[model samples]
Every structure is written in C-alpha cells, then in structure tokens.
Target: MAIKAVENKFKKFFYSRLSLFLLLLAVIWLSLVLVKTFYRRHQLDNEISSLKGEIDKLEKKHQELDQLISYVGSQDFLEKEAKDKLNLKKEGENVAMINESALGREVAGEAATTTSAQNPAGSNNENKLIQWWKFFFSR
Candidate 1:
C-alpha cells in the first residue's frame, strides 16, 4: 500500500508542466552562468600572461642597466669615454685640432653626391630640416 501511494505521487510530479518547465529553465540558466564564468577566467588568464611577459622584459632591462652601471664605474671605461668625448690626454700625448668647416664641407659634399645619384629629380626640401629636428630632439 505504501509503495503504491509513493508511485502515484511520483507519476503526478513527473507529469506536472510547471515542474518540467522549471527543470529546463534551471539547466539553461546554469549553462549560461558556466559559460560566462569560463570566458571571464580565460580573459583573466590572458591578462596574467601579458603581465608576466612585461615583468620579464622589465627584469631584463634592469639587468642590462646594472651591467651598464658596472661598466661605467670602471676606470678603463671612464678613461676611454673621457678621451673620446672630452679630448683628455695622458702625459706626453699630443692633441690635434681639425677645422669644423672642413669636416662639414666634406660631409655636405658627400651628401650632395649621394642625393644626386639616388634621386635625379629632387628630394623634398623639408626632409633635411625634419631630419635635423629629429636628430636634435632624439639626442
């Protein structure tokens, strides 16, 4: 008798349209939630990977800067830089002075020759001025 009553209740519950519709809605809602969570997790993982790459790049740059600092602190590197940039000389060393105009003329002559060879018609007038500006600004 008890088994038969339970079986009747199960049959009624299974046939109810409201119960069936609620079960379907629950499944669909859960699926949507899971998909959204998965997509968000993937996006966060990509962001983490990008940040890790940036960290590696920064670490490499820091190492390079440390090496440069050590090199600059050395006596040999300082002496070489001083000699090249400041024209420093040791005892018994003779320094030579060359004319700036002559160097400029040589460079200008070479540039004119190259320009004529490359472009027979003519180059943009603003190109040289822009290049000079860029060189000055970049330095």
Candidate 2:
C-alpha cells in the first residue's frame, strides 16, 4: 500500500499544471526559431535572384562589347575610318569642293525670305537708327 501511494504521487507531479505550462513555453520557443529560419531562407533567395539578374546583364554587355571589338577590327570599319579621318580616296575617285560661305549666305537669305513672308507686318524695312529707337523706347 505504501508503494501504491508513492506511485500515485509521481503520476500527479508529471501531469500537474506547472509541467503543462513549461511544455507550452518550450513549444512556443521552437516555433519562433522555425519562423526565423524560414524568413532568413526567403531573404537569401531574393538576394540570389537579384545577383543572377545582374550577372545576366553584365554578360549581355560583355557580348555586345566583344561584337563591337570585332567590328572595329574589320576592313570595312578601317576603310571608313581612313576615308573620314585621313581624307583618303580609292583610285579614279573624284572629289568635289564646296564653298561653305556661299552655301551659308544662300541658306540665310532663304530663311530671311521665308520669315518675312510668314509675318509681313513684322517685316517692314526700317533704317538702323529707327530700329534702335524703336527697340529702346517702344513699350
């Protein structure tokens, strides 16, 4: 009978409110650790994705630079550069000389005529003195 009483006391201690409360606390702690682990994993995944995108963009730029290097080394590009920078020409080629001053005067005259036609009231011919007076004194 004494042994039975001891056994009952042991069972009551194991099933008491204090034990249940301690168990609940342990469960909450473990759940918080699990959630933190999952959040860190998600953050790492996003970082990896962004890094991969940057790598892809850099690789594409590297490919474009390689293509440009190849093009610059080609004969066509070299010939064009020589013709433009060195003023070189092939055999039997004729070169024309343009008078820039004459072209500029013609263009200016045409523009003035067009402006005068567009605004006839604003295009009256006035002497320089009259023009200066109007500019300084007119409201």
Candidate 3:
C-alpha cells in the first residue's frame, strides 16, 4: 500500500507541466555551474604550470649568478681586471703599450679620405669653417 501511494505521487509530479519545467530549469542551472567550475579549474591549472616554469627559470638564473659571483671573487679574475684596467704587470714583465691617439688618428684619416672621395668640394668647405666656432671662442 505504501509503495502504491509513492508511485501515485511520482506520476502526479512527473505529469505536471509546471513541475517538469522547474525540473528542466534546475538541470540547466546545475550544468552551467559545472561548466563554470571546470573552466576555473582549467585556468588555475594553467596558472600553476606557468608559475612553476617561472620558478625553474629563476632557479637557473640564480645558479648562473652564483657561478659568476664565484668566478669574480677568484684570483684569476682579479689578475685579469688588474692587468687590463690598471695596466699592472709582474716584476721583470715588459708591458708594450699601443699609442691610442695614433690609432684614433689612423681611423679618422681613413674616414676623411672616404668622405673626400665622395664629395671633394664639400669636404674642403666643411673642414675650413667647422673650426671657426671654436676658434672665435678660444681664450
């Protein structure tokens, strides 16, 4: 008797147009919620993967910086810097210095030759008057 009554109630609920419409709406709402949840989960997963990649890159950079620091602190690097920047050498070691001004003049001479080849008249004109501004202001 109890089973029959439950079955009757189920049939009545299923047959009602209002109840069926409400049921369909509930189903649609639940599906939309599920889709939203899945999309958010996917977004979070991508963010996590990118963050992990960034961490790996940072770790590699840190290792490179540590190696550079160790190398810079060594005696070899110090000796090299001193020799290059300070022009220091051990006793009895001959240091041959190149004349920087002469090398510069050579380069300037080549550039002047090329410009004269391109425009001979223009070169002569520009060269003469170029020093007039500096000449007039000189003490």
Candidate 4:
C-alpha cells in the first residue's frame, strides 16, 4: 500500500495537464514581451537617426550663416554698400546730379495755379496755420 501511494504521487506530479499548459502560457508571454521590447528599441533607434540628420543639416546652415555674417561685416562689403546706397565718394571727387527734365516738364504741366489776387496772401497764411494746428492736434 505504501509503494502504490508513492507511485501515484509521482505520476500526478509529472503528468498533470494543467501544469504543462501553465508552463507553455508563461513561455508564450515571455516571447511576446521580448518581441515588444525589441520593436520599441528599433523605433527609438530610427528616431535618433532622423534627429542626427536634422542636427547635421542645422550645423551646415549655421556654418553658411557664419560665413555670410563675416563677409557682411568686412570693410569691402561695407564700402560697396555705402557707395551704392549713400552715393559716397573719396576726397576730391565731384558729385553730379542728373537732371530729370522730362519728368519735371510733366510735373509742371500737372501743377495747380492759384493766383494771390484770387486766394489772397492772408487767406493762404491762415490756411497753413490751420493745417499745422490740425496736424499737431491729430497727432
């Protein structure tokens, strides 16, 4: 009777279907967790690669801007800008003003004619004074 009881216990310990099913479920769960971890790691690596690329592009742009700033700050560039914009010249150089005769003739034709006899000198001065007052008050 003692030998039979020991043999039945050993058989139950080794051949229980529920225990086997639980072991299999644990292995499957572990495999799923490992797969999810690996996938997330791969996604993060791709994001890092893209961020590195963006950093490289910004670095190149920064280098270009630095060069441009250096050039603009140079005396040569300043002289060119001054000559073009302000029409500056060296000492002993004569500055000539080009006449726009055609444009002046067109403007002369469009000018209003107001005679002092019709408008009166006092009225014109009064109009100017009133305009100045209105401008100052409006501002």
Candidate 5:
C-alpha cells in the first residue's frame, strides 16, 4: 500500500508540472503575437499619415494649376501676347518700335573712334589674331 501511494503521488506531481509548463508556453506565444500586431499597426499608421500629407500637397498644387490655366485662357492674356509677340495694336493706339541695330552701330562707331584715338600705338602693336578677335567681339 505504501508503494502504490508513492507511485500515485509521483504521477500527480509530474502532470501538474507539465500543465504549468504548457500554460507558460501558451502565454509567451500570445504575448509575441500581440507585440507583432501592434508593431504592424504602428507602421501602417505612419504610412497612412504621410500619404495624407502628400495628398494635401497635391491638391493645393492642382488648385494653383487650375487658377493658372484660367488666367492663361482669358482674353487679356491673349491680347497681351498678341501685342508683345505679333506686334498687334488696338485701333487708334500708336505703336512705336525702336531701331536697335542702327542705334547700336552709331554708338559702336563712336566707341571705336575714341578707343583708337586713345591707344593708336597700342592698336598697331596688336597681333593679327588679337585684331580679328577685337573686330568680331569688341562691341
């Protein structure tokens, strides 16, 4: 009878220890799963917030482009373009165009005469390459 009671006690002790180990393992696995889920949720939230900010910027840009498009399509913009590019003018409006090349030539001739008068000896001493360079690029 003493030996039977000892065997039964051993069995009960072993089962209790096994059950405790299994419960501990299950708790650890559940904790790991919860931690991983929280990390994933945090990553997704950060991505969502960044995307929302990008969307807002894009919306603002879109609005600005729409305004620019409307302005470009207006009649005032068309008239301005015609006057500036095509030289078109309204009736009774005087349009004066300056002759730039003729004015430039007159100014350039005076400059060349003054430069030559100031340094006649220096001008003569210059090489052919220097002379050609001055002729093409002086003005």
Candidate 6:
C-alpha cells in the first residue's frame, strides 16, 4: 500500500509538470505566430502606401498628357503654326512684308545723321580708318 501511494504521487507530479510544459510551449508558439502576422501586416501596409504614391504620380502625368493632346488638337495652335511656318494667309487678308535690308539701311542712315549732327566739324565722307585715327589721336 505504501508503494502504490508513492507511485500514484509520482504519476500526479509528472502529469502536472507535463501539462505545464505543454501549456508553455503552446503560449510561445502563439506569440511567434502573432509576431509574424504583425510583421507581414506592416510590410503589406508599406507596399500599399508606395503603390498609392505611384498611382498619384501616374494620374498627374496622365492629366498633363491629356492637356497636351487637347492643345495639340486645338484650331488656334494649328492656325498659329500654319501662319508662322507655312506663311498661309486667310482669305481677304493682305500680308505686307517690309524689306529688311531697306529697313536696316534707313536705321543706319538715321544713326549716321545723329552722329554727324553731334560732331559738326567731322565729315560724313571720312573713311573708317581716318575716323579711328582721329578718335585715338584727338582723345
């Protein structure tokens, strides 16, 4: 009877320790699973935020391209390009072109007249070399 009681006490102690160990192991496994789940959720959130930024950039670019396309298709843009590049005039429009060489000569003549008026003693017919010599020597 004494031996039987000792065996029963030992069995009870062993089972209690085994149950405690199993419970501890289960708790550790659950902690690891929870930690892994949190890490994965954080990674997914970062990916989603990055994708949203990319989507916003793409949407802005799409809008810019749409505006460019609209401008390219506009009649005002086409008419301006035609008039400037192809020199096309509308019906009943008279295009007068001033002679660039004549305009330049007139401007040069006015400048010469003004300079000559400033220096009454200097002759307008004087050569450039003579004018330079007089300028350096007189100054």
**Which residue runs of candidate 5 sit more than 4 Å off their true CA positions?**
1-15, 99-114, 117-139
Pairs with steric clashes in candidate 4: none
Question: What's the best-to-worst order under TM-score?
Answer: 2, 3, 1, 5, 4, 6
Give each model a TM-score: 0.64, 0.67, 0.67, 0.57, 0.63, 0.56
TM-score of 1: 0.64
Clashing pairs in 6: none
- Candidate 2, residues 13-86, lDDT tens digits: the string is 87999988998999999999999999999999999999999999999999999999999999999989988899
The global C-alpha lDDT for each of the candidates, from Candidate 1 onward, is 0.91, 0.90, 0.93, 0.88, 0.91, 0.91
lDDT over C-alpha atoms for residue 4 of model 3: 98
- Candidate 3 regions off by >4 Å? 1-6, 106-139
* Pick by lDDT: 2 or 6, better one: 6
lDDT of 3 at 14: 92
What is candidate 6's lDDT per residue for 8-74, written digit by digit as tens? Answer: 9988876797878987999999999999999999999999999999999999999999999999899
Error of 3 at 38 (Å): 1.0
Off by over 4 Å in 2: 1-10, 97-102, 112-139
At residue 55, candidate 2 shows an lDDT of 100
- Which residue pairs come into collision in candidate 2? none
Q: What is the Cα-based lDDT of residue 127 in candidate 3? A: 75
lDDT of 2: 0.90
The residue pairs that clash in candidate 3, if any, are: none
Which RMSD values do the candidates have, in order?
Answer: 14.2, 7.0, 6.9, 9.9, 7.9, 7.2
Candidate 3, residue 66: Cα displacement in angstroms equals: 1.3
